[model samples]
Target: MTTLAIALGALVLYLIAYNTYGKWLGQKVFRLNKDHIAPSIELEDGNDYVPTKKGIVFGHHFTSIAGTGPIVGPALAVMWGWLPALLWVLFGSVFIGAVHDFGALVVSMRNQGKTVGDIAGNVITPRVRVLFLLILLIALSLVLAIFGLVIAVVFRLFPQSITPCLLQIPLAIVIGFFVHRKGFNILIPSVLSLGIMYLSVVFGNLGFLADSNATLAAWPVMTWVTLLLAYSFVASVLPVWVLLQPRDYINSLQLISTLALVVVGLVVASLFGGAPIDGLRPPLEIVAPAIEQNVTAKQLPLIFPFLFVTIACGAVSGFHCLVSSGTSSKQLKCETDARFVGYGSMLTEGFLAVLVILACVAGLGLGLNKGDEFLTGTAAWNAQYSDWASSKGLAAKINAFVTGSSNFLQSIGISATFAKALMGVFVASFAATTLDSACRLQRYVVQELAGCFIDFKHRKLAEPLKTEKSFQARKTSWLTNKHVCTITACLIAWWMASLPAIPGASGIFGQPGSGGVILWPLFGATNQLLGGLAFLVILFWMRRKNMPIWFISLPTFFMLILPAWAMLYQIFVAAIGSDQSWIEQGRWLLVGIGSATIILEIWMIVEALISWKNLQKTAIQQD
Candidate 1:
């Protein structure tokens, strides 16, 4: 009953927020004019800038942003209890996440499809443009590395998922070719392709494929990570509609189906089953006492700052800003569509996050069924989450979601093995979509940054560089090459992912080659900080246009201060204040990177303030 309440309540709030606040921002604040020509129509090239229907663009945008962040972040944050996580995911998504995403998309669309970082130059200053790009590059590098490791880990832990996950590539290609080239109806073909993918899921679980073979099983996690990164390199370089757009469309379908299944299962288990729901999977209890009690009996940091950082994508993530401006803005057919594609899609992700919380909390309450033995929900959840600091705890956190999701499926009469397999495929597919998109975004960042070094005014240098005629020109143009940028981005991410997990610092979930976890502590701070910076950028743009500034300002200030405070605590107390050596503890690298990001953010904020004052003065003078 509690699960159903939370789920329905979140949905209602989101709908209200969308209709009221989201619409207000779109109509009054941003003034999204339907008559305005978007970049998609103006710059159509049968590639990235091709005009797309709102539905297709929404699918692409949703899947790209709805990665493992929503899943993993909420899964981890449930450690502090479901209530705190729930409130943040609900309120944060409605107010902060949707607004940030919508503003970024609309601003970019109005600015000729330029990225947020690129638009900073015009709105703030040229120097801030480079600074914003630097922040984006660092953030994207971590995203590429972390998501790649996450998908690889999913494949390793759930072998049955590999077949369906790998099948998405070819299926998407076929769909792309038929719809874009042969002009087939996208709906029928997409449904058929999804049906085929699900068939692979069943067969893969039944061991009818090579994925279950001993040879593939013997390969290390790093091997899978390497292959995934290589694949992302190719996916990143392809034109949007050819592979990226269609693939994300299919993934979005899978996500919707999964969410629907979980919701239905929760309702049936909670309302219809009566005693079974209570005895087997008990109602969700606030468990306020346990919030401070972990398996290891260590107290976590105060919920204020950490909760905001932890429940990142499920609530608000800075990365969504990049997605809004980087890709979605370019593909919008109508300026008005930004409200749906940008704002509505984020609310959808928030609902998914709500379901994730229910799955981890209420679903886990169903307990673990192993053969004839059973563990209560409390015991099972505690067993995996006893110690947040242990290296192995990361694996436990991920497995908790799988186990709980499978339990939910069982309530609907699905066999446990198939249930687990289904959930595994869902998670792996989500991560794979994010990994490829990050690679593509990173390539864009690299190219944009590389352009800064080129003397575009010197045609002798720039024009010949396009032909690779002179050695100097070739050197200058290499960074601008799509393939070069993609490969370089992949390799860097691969290196970060492949590094050895720090000894003794591995949380209970840590494993060798799980280097991405080392950087996890910094992810929330950096991500939210990026959100703050993005909001700041939006605020500056609004001020310049003489629009209402309060809507963007509050979130900007809230996001900036909380995450920065949390990061400072992490640096001074958790990393340096403790007796552990910074290098041995793996805090040095994170501290340095996090500090640099904070500095860049502060610099940009200062620049925006100065610009705001000048803009005010100029307006007064004109008046």
Candidate 2:
């Protein structure tokens, strides 16, 4: 199928899901009845429990979850052939990601706007909560560490993007102060922020900061790491009104604008740069027995892990579950709002992924085939195409578009400058927002842990010790609270990035992109696994409400089995020796992650069984 067809089909399917099935799921299953209030009603804090407008809340939520991850994942997914990448993104988003995210929010809202970790404990049992927390902490550390590397790579490649990003912070701070302190509303601050950030981009192009030692000098790797950690520190401590909220508000515009540009480019490329009927060739054609055998021997059903790995965003992202259960739930005023903001926003991101896939497909060339051949997977093909594409003009065209100086400018020469200026506005906004969101989640985990310890401390046959307010207050102290958690989070992330900077360190894990061969693919598999866990939890929740389980259970089971088999393949490959270093490392990494997930899943299963037994015992005793 052509790229255009994929894009149109994805859009149609998403709209249908959102309008019909999603709506039904919300009303009938999720029961977003207007009569129902968020359980937080008994204990609303205006800061976190303010009645939020769904549109504003969605905008806030989307910007927070949409990070550099989406861009990086799709960009790399081009490796597996655009078709594999496209299908994973399109299907996974709706079935797995949207369900996980939307369900996390719904579950948390049902339980007094508690964080995900807390809800798991209260609804399931303390043992389940503890296990879930460990999983989250480890997962989060991996996320921050890897993502720091992504940002560093971009900066290393495009030194020009530095000054613009740096300049954006103060501009965002000023705009944020303008809105909150100076009492301006969103519209004016947003315009001012965008205009200024766009200017910074133009300045970057002019080479103005290219040589400025004061602001633009290339620092050592350690310096960048330190700077990023410090930024995370401040971002986590700062109130959402000061930096996080305002910045995200503006970045939302930037994201929309970028998406629009991509759409426009794809349309222009497709209409003007149409490929032959066979524009896309099966990437598998040139594959050798060795590689295919390895993939098969790995026992990876080919479709299972591959599909899960490729579709990394909006749908079934474990990261978003943290956010949904973290601060978002606390702030939700109405239970029904989860369906619109959580489920709806993910559908939107899914559409964006489809659009990106379409862009790649449209840009692929059949003859002279610069883009298409570069996508195939033989070592010789990689080396040969790298030479051929360079010998041709492929490199230059790619450079131009990436640097944002291609014919893409002719359409919006002026607006382009304005957009560039707002680069800082977008970065600081989302970066700060995510920082705080991360902090809130960390704090929630800490509080839960503290409660466990305090309970253990008072286990004697004396009077039951009350530990609610005192322990919570200690956990929330500014010195010991969100700021500390944020700093800790960022520092750990920086440490991870620094490892990649070492000459042999990056390859120590595996070849650079091949991290996904293990990391991305396993991430996909575990993500689906998490979906299984989430589905079970939600299924149990539904049963509690006397609802039928078929609708949720069937898809959940299929998604679960498919990805598990895929992960098993990866584990098999890792366990067996492949001569290829890159694939070998990838196999091992997948096995490691799969093993950890299985252990965690087992713990979760046992906890759920115990909780069920206890409930049954209580019911019998009552009878």
What local lDDT does model 2 show for residue 372?
Answer: 48
How well does model 2 score by local distance difference test?
A: 0.56
Question: Which 10-residue window in model 2 sums to the lowest lDDT?
Answer: 283-292
Residue 118's C-alpha lDDT in candidate 2? Answer: 60
lDDT tens per residue, model 1, 445-516: 887777655533333733642233433543567768888888878877778777756655543124444667
Per-residue error for 470 in candidate 1, Å, reads: 18
TM-score of each: 0.91, 0.77
The sequence of per-residue lDDT tens digits that candidate 2 reaches over residues 233-331 is 566566544555555556666666766665564444344442222453222122212122233333333444554544566445666877777666765
Residue runs of model 1 more than 4 Å from their true location after superposition: 208-217, 274-296, 369-373, 390-392, 455-476, 503-513, 575-586
After superposition, candidate 2 runs with Cα above 4 Å error? 33-52, 78-80, 178-183, 212-217, 274-301, 364-440, 460-480, 494-528, 558-572, 575-594, 610-623
